[model samples]
Target: MNKKYVLFAILPFALSACQSFPTHLKKNEAMIVETQSPDLLQTLSDYTWIYQSSEKLPPIVLDLDAQKRIFIKTGCNNLMGAWQFDGKQINTAPLAATQMLCPPEFMAQEHTAFQFFNQAQLNASINISNPVHPLLTLENKAGQKITFKGEIKPEAKYKSTGEVVFLEVSPNKKPCPTDNTQQCLQVKQVKYDKQGIQTQIDQSWQVLPVEIQGYQHNTKQSKIIRVKRFNTKPQTATPEYAYIYDMTIEEEVAPQK
Candidate 1:
């Protein structure tokens, strides 16, 4: 795949920070005396990490262990995989995947995801100070860094309003395949016209910046592909609704290999 296309497809978890070391580190000698080393595998087994990928409208949490067991919940689908954790490395292979087929944009994401875990090296660690979150660093053989801040949650609820939203397609500007045609990113704006209540909804899409077939092609063009059904609705106190809409941003840029 073209590097640009590959990048577009590969990024899902692409975006954290603070410098304070844990208190134990401050008292290194005391910590060493009191803290016994925990087995890495045992410490991370069955732990979950929140993941944000380009394909899904919302982030997801991934759960896996040494038993070759795995599970994940994207905003739209529940997925499964098989995992392996040798003393020094971890590997994951997706098992049977469902065919709900999210939007075209999300479809690209699904493909990207399969490509990601099919064969990748993963490093897992914990935040001793905050057990609720686990840190994961995924890297290719080249030692390039693909890291993120992930949260552990047993369940994720989804909310959706019967509505349409806009998304920004990246790689801001480029030349179209045809003469005199230009390709650029587009931002979508969605709202409930009935009440005139508007919400700027962020979305996922498989964008194609190509020229129109056979016309003068005066205007540079880009394709807009809607990915999945997202909960663009504002948060509420009650969870009575089946789905909720959320508009959030996750940029795509990682340490290069």
Candidate 2:
């Protein structure tokens, strides 16, 4: 085994998980941006707005009441901060947030709101006429933008389905690994259901696993299986045709030039 391969295997554990929010923006001078619709902005200012990401968790709600009090739900715990809105500027000073540690997922949501609040150069528009849906348009310091169509919905119920998948797994090249024999393998996807109803998994979509191992065998018995390398020519198959079942386990021989 090459010394380079041994060092490469140890590199995965070296990654550190840390998150920081930027809180250095100055607030000496007042700033405001004109909105296309004034009534929309007013309707937005009146109610507490919640932001829910695609993550499978509870929503993060931010309540901006009168008297400059800002209360936010960090998925698990509530955090309080000082906020002042002059004209259209919704300025939130650095929060004296609570030190309660929820799951890491909730912490990520808190960080997202912190960054969005800190970088608001202008508040464009907010329309909340429909109680179920609201529209918020925000602009950052660089004049780049994003539009969020907010909706309040109930949590979705999920279930487990017993279906197998044929999956092809490969380590990313460019930074090649030391294992020359072990490259990539395809496997069948495990089935899942929602609320006892079978869910549809997109065709050709792969579930990425952590390990570089190709064929997954039962631990009760030992088996030897050959697997293809990552850089092999990928065969493209259309959804209209039949689904390929066999995972290529050997080097595909090239034709004569």
Candidate 3:
């Protein structure tokens, strides 16, 4: 192991039986990138790490969410597991994964990912000097090293979990709010109750001059989607509140009668 990498993990008794990693490891934004010594667990949860092994595979996304569950996206099947970091190495429970059949290349890469994250007592190193683009390296006992680069998550960037709101987007576009020549998505607020039943929907459509992250509108079909809205910080000088696409509720094409 490299002497420069200082990993301060808990003892055996400290890491009691639990499906997830220790909650103490999961801290707020303050413990992340703003100190002389950054917390490893906090940084892992706040940033999305991209696998840097092969350029052929659609970048594998390895991230540890606030809940301490390990999530790996191989662009084929998703690999999930709960991990624990002892003072020496990392050990994860038997991984849970989706059984999706993909191309040979993707499957081949997925195999390597599954082996690494599932392996016992793996050595890991992280460097968060550049908050925007941190680097993580994991080495197996066989002397093979896998690297990943980090990108700050939206929730981390905005400093909040943000409000989850639903919207029904129209199939057609309205005139853009600022530019008359451009077109924009016409949307209305959709409300759902605790039972997941429709409660209310805004009757009138409004011009959405801004774009929602991870969303792509189809002119032929109207769709309802769930999204998170966050107040943009003054430093970014972005919109009043930034919208990120969460999931699609429903969609359909109207009969042109």
Output the number of the lDDT-best candidate.
3
Cα lDDT of model 2 by residue, 94-208, tens digit:
4545566878987887776666654244455666676566766666666655455554221100111112232323222222244544532323332224332223323453333
Candidate number achieving the greatest TM-score relative to the actual structure: 3
The alpha-carbon lDDT assigned to residue 74 of candidate 1 equals: 55
Query: Superposing every Cα of model 3 onto the true structure, what RMSD results?
Result: 11.2
Rank candidates, TM-score, best first: 3, 1, 2
lDDT of 3: 0.73
What would the C-alpha RMSD of candidate 2 be, to one decimal place?
A: 18.4
Error of 1 at 202 (Å): 41
* lDDT tens digits, residue span 1-257, model 1: 01122112222221101112233233344234224433555445535566676553666556664344565555545556555554334555434455576777666655555555554555544554555555666665555544445543222223222334323334344544343366633334333333333334445433333322122211223322233343333475532212112222223442233
The order of the candidates by lDDT, greatest first, is: 3, 1, 2
Q: What does candidate 3's lDDT look like per residue over 1-257, in tens digits?
A: 01111222212222223354333333343233224333676777788889756677688998777665677888888787766554334556567677879999999888988887763456778887877899988788787887789988888998988988888888889889899799988889987766566777888999987888889888877788888998886466564878899777777784464
Candidate 2 lDDT trough over 10 residues, lowest sum: 1-10
Error of 2 at 221 (Å): 46
Q: Each model's TM-score?
A: 0.39, 0.38, 0.73
Candidate 1 versus the native: TM-score?
Answer: 0.39
| Model 3, position 159: C-alpha lDDT score | 91
